[model samples]
Target: MGAWSRLKGAFTRDAQISSPEDLLAQSRERRSGKVPVTNDSALRNSAVWACLRLRADLMSDFPIDVYRKVSGIQVEVPKPPVLISPGGSEVGMKEWMYSTEFDLDRGGNCFGIITERSGVIGPDGRGLPGRIDLVELGSVSVRGKGSTITKYVIGGKEYEPWDVWHEKQYTVAGFPMGLSPVAYAAWTIEETISAQQFARDWFAGGAVPLAELKNNAKTIDREAARVARENFRAAVDSSGLFVHGVDWEYKPIQAVASQSAFLEARQYGATEIARFFGVPGDLIDVAMSGSSITYASIGQRNLQFLIMNLGPAVGRREEAFSRKLVSGPRFVKLNTDAMLRMDPEARARTIGARITNRTLTPDEARALDNLPPLTDEQYGQFDRLFGPRSAPTPPTTAVPGASS
Candidate 1:
């Protein structure tokens, strides 16, 4: 069976699996055809209804966490909020409700306790007795393929291009129940109060123009783009763009600079026209830093491996963490393996049959010509290294500058 089919079968046969239909039926039985309409009773009924609906929805959306969350409902109740507010307000709550109680016809079987509370004004301008809250009905988890590594053996030695394969699993906990009736009622009342308060605040001169907010957001985006462009330029410049010991070679640094400038210009233009903007040098910096670290780490790891395989004489370390030369044979072997895994047909075409003491036929040469091109850009660099042309030639003219 396919992987997904096997997973589905396992899930279907799980003893703890609870279907949404079962939960809905239990909810119906709990009400016993008598839907509560009173404010307090209605709220309780709504909470129960929410639990049923949530359970059903989560059964389809998060099948993996179903068993654990449903079975462990009793255990998840006392746990602190998976979500909460900073001001000690019970803004978010979580609870797990089980199906066993429903099956046994127990009063509290299908229910989960909600702890957090938010007060809301009633229609009579009085505080509502109950408040809106969140609860967790169950938990779900999923696992999938992670990382991959490729290795190749040539001339009685083995080389690895990528050396790690890791898998990741995710778990989420929340209520399968719908919103609590009391919470909904409280929220409606609170919204009415909030609308009035908002009107007061707005008339009290706290409200600002939507255009102004848009302008501010745009300003922030432009500033962020400017900063990003500056950082990118600095990085590229420091890395140096020139091709050493080569003629008429185009520098990749110029392309990087051009791309960075284009991105900056586009960002500035977007800031001028767009209504929404992002914060400058905030969370984006964290992401950029992470990306930099990932790229650097991978490059460093590969370089280290290559140097080690090349041996001490040619691959001398300039610093404790630096390598002077790398093993060409090992690099080629590893690259071939990676290519084979990524594109088997292409690898087969590139590494055609090698018959001993045989001359290539014209048809064979033609077949070779029809083979797919190499995906790696490094091969082009290698070709240039050994080719007649060795130095990069300056561009005759700069690319047309963008109109401000």
Candidate 2:
């Protein structure tokens, strides 16, 4: 059975696996009705591709770091080889993150096989997976029992839960597998695709341009009419100009009303698809009408997107990584400071305010700009130019008597 069919069955408590014959029948039924859509085919839709690309790109750019809680305080630790090279040296962390995140966003589930292990043991008494090779979502199958997945089948081979890595989102109370946003938004995507195809076909030999031409000088026969039509089309196509005598009358055609509506429908479809993927329409260049919310800077826009849309997915991934990839008090965090960085002017102003308020030290602020601490010579130069920094007065008795 295709994963799409299995995904649909997951919503029900009594869902059962269908035999190959039954699956074939279902496939035929779908073929007889509406066209069946697959993940690869769905990408042909511009809006769907844009939404998935935006989500995957943003998630992959953020660095994933490991931290350990020591004495009730969290301290960053070096990431293990599993995180640095999750799919082995062939695939680095950035590419692995992008592939897995792309799958999770599009299919609602990502699966991988544990290929190698490290010497360090985890809580489960086995060494953590040193390398995990991500599997294609279409090639994997899961058997679940009321919110718990029992077995994973990949390439006709069954594996235990510990031997596999699975991450899911858009979860439900009873279903073990996550629900796919692409499946839910299939209708909208298909409609937009159809409209786009129609437009392409219409312009490419589907319909002739509606127009009429007549010669006031004389009446032409069938052969002459064909010659004149071919000559006019050739002239128009070659130079975009058809010169003729005053005896010839030409009237151009106007598009039908229904054809114009398809443009608006496609735009609306893009907005709806962006919403399904939890991406802002503006980020993907989808036009929005009557939008009141505006950002003072790019940082504000990114902050809003992080908080309202991408934050939950990041939290879920953190929990999954912390639970499965490491032992003891170590946890995973996807650093979002890069995504939330402000423009240069706004960043300077904010850092300056923090330094003035004593909430941030000058060196720390400099570190934010990736600069090293100032040396004694540089400090002396600043002192000479801007005068010495202020300091608190020291208490003294003998010094006070001398002054008196």
Candidate 3:
């Protein structure tokens, strides 16, 4: 093989596309210095907001379940210290969920620093993590075995990875380093932001018909030009009048926002950026998507979203939590029932079918509906409806009228 071919092969095989260095090289070589979405200004984009909203919904709506193994059976971890007020005093599950989601989605990593020693013990004599502080993604850096993160360098202090619970997206480097979404799609996001800004500025940045106030008599002074500018703005903006100076003729300087295709380009960019972040472009581009095509139902749409986008991502999170938080049969489960909640009638039918198939129990189905457990009377009624007496009643030997 040629030397050049060998080098090309190496680059293709070893290219860490997720790394900022390679991403920057590509953007700079082709795009005009793409700006990272980490900026405060970049977060204002509608597409960015949509991505954030989706991540937040996934994290917060799907509740966390902590379970422990006792003997040979698995049950809920009795008063799991981590779940009970994870985000320190006063903050609870909701706060923990959002912040963690924010970090994992944007920075590709979420950390929970075990703090606040409660100085108390559980029945098993396991001293609980009193409080959990979420470390800022930008503040921590990894240092350890193949990115196993032996230490988290935060605020000039080093912390053991064990002390700071971490959940990170898988990477080629085998380190816990998560690729930043903003960085990965920087070029697309930057272009979108630029186009939107251009449109805004074109309309609001003193856009007006320029009339060459050619004072052939003498050069116009600064004060005179300033007065003329103010007058021109007031005349054009306030009223559709053309106030001008002496010996000045109108010059057509029409606003060319449409001609520039600023909004169109911005919409395209927004859609592309949304796709880059695994959000459906149509969610942020209603006008572009058009109304002819429609989802059969919201449930189907959500199911598609889960299957095509979030399924693998959720699985990665499950593995991360299971590997880091617990040792044995104890594991974490993200209850996606919230996302699976269908239309009332649809849900009822589906649950009933599942019960018929014996895959889901009546109690389990009721739990999905957020209803309390059935009372004895309700249970008896259910038994009568579909339980032990599912078979036909024994044929009576004695006739109804003439009893034995």
Candidate 4:
């Protein structure tokens, strides 16, 4: 335990608690010739936002199911009230899950204060969580001795570890807190943001090249030059005509390479961000070259994403939910079948094939499409269109010989 605690402290050496307002202010500040890295500033990049949103959106859409091992098979069980409405009557599980996942993706940690618990006792002396109100990470301070979190200070108020619900990902050995990917990707995100700002400022005339308007016949004085330059800039800025004398010549300096390089840098930043967030570049509309990968269908692409990118995150969440939300043999499963849903035509063919092969019942297939079972009239209609579904043939041995 002591060794584990020491390792955990090493990972969280710079841990500090601050208000959201303070974090936002710090994010706006420039420090040591680099943009201050914070969740808010990192999200300023469109690619970063897209990656986080994609993960959170998909993860939240997946339905949560509780199951217990029965006879060596997973049998679905009734979800605890906390799993159903984790945040209380005002917030459903989907919204809660989305918020939690968003935090995990951004900060690698999520903190919530348990407000209520069920009557059923869990492994911990406290009952299972009935309501957990998520707190902003900035407002929560985690204090631990070695690997054991002694307490949580949220909004300057203290609470026991049992009273605080914490989930972390991207973990290392003995670390109670997850490592923030944003922290590691800070330079990339900052570079992207700096490029964006440069582009904005450049278009706004901050970096416009100096131009000289000189008289071919006679040299102009400083005062005359300043007036002419101001007039020219004002006219250009407002899209007004700048009528110059024929004697005067205007030659503007142009550096086209910088603009082209800026564009390339921006593209590279997007691709890098996609990589950092474990999202496919194409999924976020990030252009990349020198790749020949292709997907036969959207389902195949989604399947690859589910397996490669989201699988581990989903597993971590499942483990956390199983350990904390349920007890004994019961476990939690986030149904990712929704992510792999095929197009209507493809889905129909697959379901039809399953029914034909006796792998799935007609009613069960209908349920997959969220339709109710067929009535007698519908069965009659089906029988008229196609022969009735054949019942399995009964096997006979000695009885068949006797009948013969």
- Poorest stretch of ten by lDDT in candidate 2: 19-28
TM-score-sorted candidate list, best first: 4, 2, 3, 1
The number of the candidate with the highest TM-score is: 4
User: Model 1, 1-404: lDDT tens per residue?
Assistant: 54223323433442222222222222221223223222223223222333333322222221111011354352222211221221135332222112321211111112122222324332334332232222222221111122111332222333332111111111112321222222223333233333344444554545422112122223456776576446555755699543323222222222354345444543332222111111122112212223333323343433442343222311111111011011111110011121113244544444454312235443464465584544357557867788653554656765688554
Best-to-worst lDDT order = 4, 2, 3, 1
Where in model 1 is the C-alpha error above 4 Å?
2-8, 11-133, 136-246, 251-404
Model 3 / residue 125 / CA error / Å: 16
- Error in Å for residue 375 of model 2: 1.2
Worst 10 residues of 3 by lDDT: 16-25
> What would the per-residue lDDT of candidate 2 be over residues 147-182, giving only the tens digit for each residue?
676777787898898999888898766667676777
Q: In terms of lDDT, which candidate is strongest?
A: 4
Q: Model 3: residues >4 Å from true position, as ranges? A: 1-39, 68-79, 116-130, 142-150, 206-248, 256-260, 285-287, 290-293, 358-404
Task: List where candidate 2 sits over 4 angstroms from the true fold.
Answer: 1-34, 205-256, 290-292, 393-404
Backbone clash total for model 2 is 0
| Model 1, TM vs. native | 0.14
Whole-model lDDT, candidate 1? 0.28
lDDT minimum window of 10 residues, candidate 1? 324-333
Local distance difference test values of all predictions, in order: 0.28, 0.79, 0.65, 0.82
